[model samples]
Target: MRPELEPGHVAVVTGGARGIGLAVVEALGARGVGVLCVDHPDADTSAFVAACEAAGVAHAVASLDVRDRDAVRAGVATAADLGPVAYAVNCAGVDGLHPASGMTADEWRRVVQVDLDGVMFACQAEHDLLAGRGGSIVNIASMSGHVVNRGVTHAAYSAAKAGVIHLGRSLAVEWAPLGIRVNSVSPGYTMTAMTATNPPEVNAGFAAQTPMGRLAEVEEVAEPVVFLLGRRASFVTGTDLLVDGGFTAW
Candidate 1:
């Protein structure tokens, strides 16, 4: 673990209750970084609490909707209460698969609001908290942002994720002088609570599309995210790390 991620430092992770977000929280905790796990109001925090206890790190859970700017600001403020917030992972996102032609305005807005706008809101709040102290931020994007999925018809999801990837780059430049680094991680098809609910054939198709011949584990995505959040990636900013098992390469 890098010194930047050591004890006495804290992190704020949105969507920390499950999936890739939970994995990032666990990874940060293992590095002795106190964590503030922020998830939706109704998200279950049992797993997050267990991970923190096992790692023996100071921890708190905030029920926050990343779509709300005020709520996101308050969440970051709460994390600061734990310790010096050195890192943040914006993992709160949603995906809606609907063909563009038939997609209702409401459906498109819902996905964009949660995926792109939510990430922006969190980044804004995080930037304010770490303005002078220097910190790193990782936003969770998707391979869909780089390439269209073969059998999926989710134009809105793809567009939002693309926005997230670019947003990180734009902020990285703006915040660099302030000592804050911003980056994004784009994961390929991954095994998660939500994807686990899909039919076997559906998952198999996703795996078949990838050169790796398998979906990514949540840990795989979290590892790169943690890397970008630490000093190891000190010179790495204004970029998107693709943790997609070469899914985008093909």
Candidate 2:
């Protein structure tokens, strides 16, 4: 059974302007949770705010670069002012695909900074607000973190995602006593703006390898995140939830 939505809960989602992030925002809003959509400065953030308004859920948008510590702190503070931040979903990340031998140091740092360091900063900024009340944190990792994707070379992305899983696990251990649950959702080839950049044939190849024989819909992955953030997974923490269409089964 699906868990019931409780009123007075607020959820903050990074990268909430589009793709999987937007799907997560809609999901949380559908469950009656107030939402704060955080996106980069140039993104069309007004759409997110408009959607929330249409849904009749309280909402706000903050332009933030998760890599900026001060910006993350201020963004979290702004969200907290709306209500107790009961949930945080860190979905802001970048993908760098290059041959390991030819990858540049800057390329590596860019992926790691957004995918790994950014998650840590967002979580840390919201830690105090979630402390006494206990909240849920769902970090968006990737199936690449658990298995090698020989078709695509993304050494930096995979490495940073691996770090994300460990970061969530460690935070779970430290925050469980305070009632805060930290978990991760690792999605496989899903149909999102990120994956949309891939050549059609490339996406098809990934679909063929999955047991489910198709790429995932945005909502397919979003639902898992909603579950993790809701009461249904009250006992789940310090673990990674794989929504990969069985891609890792082999």
TM-score versus the correct structure, for each prediction: 0.97, 0.96
The alpha-carbon RMSD values of the candidates against the true structure, listed in the order shown, are 1.1, 1.4
- Residue 110 of model 1, lDDT score: 92
- Please report, in order, the local distance difference test score of every candidate based on alpha carbons: 0.91, 0.89
Off by over 4 Å in 2: 1-3
lDDT of 1 by residue, 112-147 (tens): 999999999999988888997989999999988999
Clash count for each candidate, listed in order shown: 0, 0
Worst 10 residues of 2 by lDDT: 1-10
Q: Work out how many backbone clashes candidate 1 has.
A: 0
Give per-residue CA lDDT, model 2, range 76-126, as digits (tens): 778887777889999988898899899999998899999999999999977
What residue runs in model 1 are displaced by over 4 Å at the alpha carbon? 1-4
lDDT, candidate 1, equals 0.91
